[model samples]
Target: MKFSAERATLLKALAHIQSVAEKRNTIPILANVLIHAADGQLSLKATDMEIEVVEVIPATIKREGATTAPAAVLYEIVRKLPDNVLVELDQADGDTPLQLRADRYATRLNVLSVDDFPSMGAGELPCRFKLNAGVLRSLIDRTRFAISTEETRYYLNGIFFHAADADGVPLLRAVATDGHRLARVETDLPEGAAEMPGVIIPRKTVAELRKLIDEAPEEIEVALSETRVQFTAGSIMLTSKLIDGTFPEYDRVIPRNNNRILRVGKKDFSDAVARVAAISQERSRPVKLTLEPGLLTLSASSPEQGVAKEELDDNRISYDAESLEIGFQARYLNDITDQVEKEVEFAFSDSAAPTIVRDVDSPSALYVLMPMRV
Candidate 1:
């Protein structure tokens, strides 16, 4: 196989696909990326069994053939090559190593037969839809932080994506939770996605998709089936097997009648929480929020480190309760506030009930945090 490609173009494609290949592999072929040169294009593929990424870039093909080489090594070689130079890859015989040549560099990398590469299965998708890249990016960003890292409750390890009705209006929603906290974001349903099945997009797949759509690609084509989900944008396609599990009914946990509403500046609340929690126990990092008619105070204490406290402007906050004190992990408070750009509304029933947090202006995104016992 022989082909030539521009240094910058080739490097970008290789850099993105190589990340899918694991460095230490029980199976040798898993460490190599499949390179196929044909039809005036070079296709690079890398997979770690669960997720696969395929990228195609325009290249000059002198011979149509395929081979596999160490993904990381090839990427480094292409990245270090002089910009704008043409990189040539040649393999004259089936038993010969792949030859790479740049302006002043030349080397042969051991190659594995392309037939050894794992096959990516993308079943026929009954639901295919097109969504604006910006919209999809927003949905993922809002909920990804709450995805569970726990391995036992595998269902919560990724974002739960499905179609739901919000106030009689159909909307596409992404929900994630780790028991202690939950995040839910919703957007208008894309055309042709009415029947899309609920799917748990694995954490790794969500991360890869985030990278691909970060540049704000104009539109993304999404195809979904019972077992897998595929996304295509520009010259790249990512396919992954969905987690086979049922997500709990999270709506039941979202507080609906917690009317003790308190509005506070997001930055103020976040900073206060961080300061008070500085003296909190290492294990829990617990911060207590004490709310009253016209004052809100945050405090934390550790037997060995003493205690810390902070008081915010009562004018910016409002609460209907006579008085209530709730405890939460300081890190969780920071995470929920980091996603908000303006004021935050905290709705609580009592010190022992789950507190609901929301951006005052963004009704589409909501966070539910269970109180930590102090």
Candidate 2:
């Protein structure tokens, strides 16, 4: 196999594909990246059996062939090469090492048979759609913070993605929860997404997909099946296996009649909660929120440390019930409020009931926080 590509082009392709290869693997070939040179393009593929990423870059090909090389080692070498330099790869035989040459540096990287690399065949994807990069990023950033980290309840360790109707209009929804708090966000369903099945995308896949969308492409192509999903951004493609588990029915956990309303600036509420929680214990870090007609006070106390209290004037705050005091983990509040824009509205039924938080300007996202007994 022989191919030549620009330093920058090869580096970018390697950066995207090498991350899918696990650093430590029991199988030797699993830690290697498969490189195929054919028809004026160089294709790089890496996988950990569960998730696979492939990137193709335009290259000048003198011979059509394929080889496997250590992914991390090759990435490091390419990253340190001089800018704009042309990199040349040559493998004379199938069993011999691959020769890598760039300017004055020359090295022979060990090679494995390309046939040993696992094949993640492209299955028939029944559902295909196109979504704007900005929309996909918003849906992930707004709800990923609430995804559960517990491995026992694997179903809760990812964001539940599905199509649902809100007020007679169809929308695509993403929901994640860790029992303490829940985040739900919705966006307009893409044209071809009506038949998309509800899938629980694993946390790792969500993180990787987030990286691809961070640069903000104009649009992303998504193909989905019952057990897997594939995302294509330009010349790069990511394929991941869906988590085989049923997600809990999250609608029941959302409060329906919590009418006690309190509207406050998102920044102010977040800042006050952080300040009060500073004196809280390391374990629980519980902060108390006291609501009244026109004032909201946040307080936190620790027997071993000290107490903190802060009061904010909220003209929109209103509650018919006697002054209600509720306790919650301060970190959870910050996580929810940080994702909100402009003002945040809170609805509560009682001290023991769950509190619902929403952004006044954007009703598509909602958060539910279960109160703690302090």
* C-alpha RMSD in Å of predicted model 1 compared with the true structure: 1.3
| Candidate 2 error regions (>4 Å) | 281-283, 315-322
List, residue by residue over 1-374, the lDDT tens digit for candidate 1.
Answer: 99999999999998888888978879999999998988888999999988999999999999999989999999999998888899999999766899999988999999888778898788798899999999889899999999999999999999999999977999999999999999999999988988999999999999999999975369999999989999999899999999999999999999888988899998888888877887855857789888888889899998898989888756767765768888998889888998898899999998889999999989999999999887
| Candidate 2 residue pairs that clash | none
- Model 1, residue 97: C-alpha shift (Å): 1.2
TM-score of 2: 0.95
lDDT, model 1: 0.90
Q: Quick one: best lDDT, which candidate? A: 1
| Regions of candidate 1 where Cα sits further than 4 Å from its true position | 280-283
For model 2, residues 1-374, the per-residue Cα lDDT tens digits are 89999999999888877788878878889889999999889999999888899988899999999999999999999999999899999999899999999999999999888899998765888999999999999999999999999999999999999999988999999999999899999999999999899999989999989988875369999999989999998888999999999999999999899878888888888988888888855857789999877789899998888889999864534444557898888888889999888889888988899999999899989999999997
RMSD values for the candidates in order, in angstroms, are 1.3, 1.7
